[model samples]
Target: MPSLATRHEGHVLVIEMQRPLLKNALSRALQHELVSAWQELEGNDDLWIAVLHGVGGVFSVGHDVPELARGEGDEADPEPVTGLFPLELSRPVIAAVEGPCYGLGFELALACDLRIAAEGARFGFPDQHLFTSHKVASVLLPHMASLGIGLDLLFTGKTLDARRAEEVRLVNKIVPEGQALAEGVAAARDMAQRFGSAEAFQKQAIWGFPGLPLSTALNLARRM
Candidate 1:
């Protein structure tokens, strides 16, 4: 079966990561599949938004270290793990996370415009090791939560449970365990019905964040 799967519910496209037995690890093949899915979400005008989750009650444990080491099938080239999606997708995504969201999994969640994490879910940055890079997390975490928390999590490889994640605004909200998908899809469907391309337009302004000058950011929002 494909590592990643996609389906549509009205204008909301749902992307599911399959690999429960392996804790939905992000192997090289799976990473490519995610990029493809994001591209589809971007190019398909009918797809307004996306909800990303994993099977078997877990978002993702992390990257498949062994696969990353040996490389996958032949030529053996590994790209820097730049999170799961493009730098900026025109369409927004929602991460419905449960269980352990670590390493690449945490990056995937952070990449989403909003995140819905199930109760008991765990979040962690990858250990500070030669094989892993947390560039995406390093950039986003400080802004998402706090600079001190980001430094602590990244440097110490500490993990946070869903309550703490929500408190820090790492996750948009926390739902009952096993309800992340249902809640996330329902929320997406509601937003899809109420909003249109305006969501993506607003995202451009939000993504600019602390970098873009206030006047410039205002112009972008106004233009959108």
Candidate 2:
């Protein structure tokens, strides 16, 4: 079976991570598949929203540590595999997480525009212990969660469960185990149909013009 699977369910494009044996870790093959899948979805007009999740019990337990440990794949910059999705995609992504989202795995969820987790889902960042730093988490965590919480997660290497994540507003919602993908896809479909392309366009405009001042941003918003 393909390590990653993509299918269109009406306006929603569901991307499922299918490496159940390894806790859905990001293998080299899976990484390439995700980039290709997302690129195809971005080019297709039939799809408006993408919902990302994993098969088996976990969303992702992060990188394939054994693979990395064995030096089995091409290595370049230490940036996480999630960086494969360039910031220019011009599409909104929602992540449905279960089990453990650790290291780069949690960063992938953070990269999404919205994240929904199953009850008891776990999140953590342990780059320091790995003798490397998480560039994405270091740069983007403060923007998503409180500075204190972000620091604690990044620096202390503690895991946060769904309830703690919800209390901190890190996850949009939490559902029963095995229901995160369904709930997340439902939310994505609703947002896509109800808001249409205007919301997507607006998000692109804002990210595309981040250097603009407040007055300039307002002017751009008016034009949109």
- The Cα local distance difference test for each model comes to 0.82, 0.80
Most lDDT-accurate candidate:
1
Error (Å) of candidate 2 at residue 148 is 1.5
Model 2 CA lDDT for position 203: 57
Candidate 1 has which clashing residue pairs, if any? none
The alpha-carbon lDDT assigned to residue 41 of candidate 2 equals 72
Judged by TM-score, which candidate is best?
1
On the 0 to 100 scale, the lDDT of residue 23 in model 1 is 88
Task: Give lDDT: candidate 1, residue 203.
Answer: 66
Where is the poorest 10-residue window by lDDT in model 2? 72-81
Tens digit per residue, CA lDDT, model 2, 108-163: 88877788999879998754557556677776677667789989997788999999
Q: Candidates' TM-scores?
A: 0.90, 0.89
Q: Judge candidate 1 at residue 84 and give its lDDT.
A: 60
Clashes of each: 0, 0
Per-candidate alpha-carbon RMSD to the true structure: 2.3, 2.4
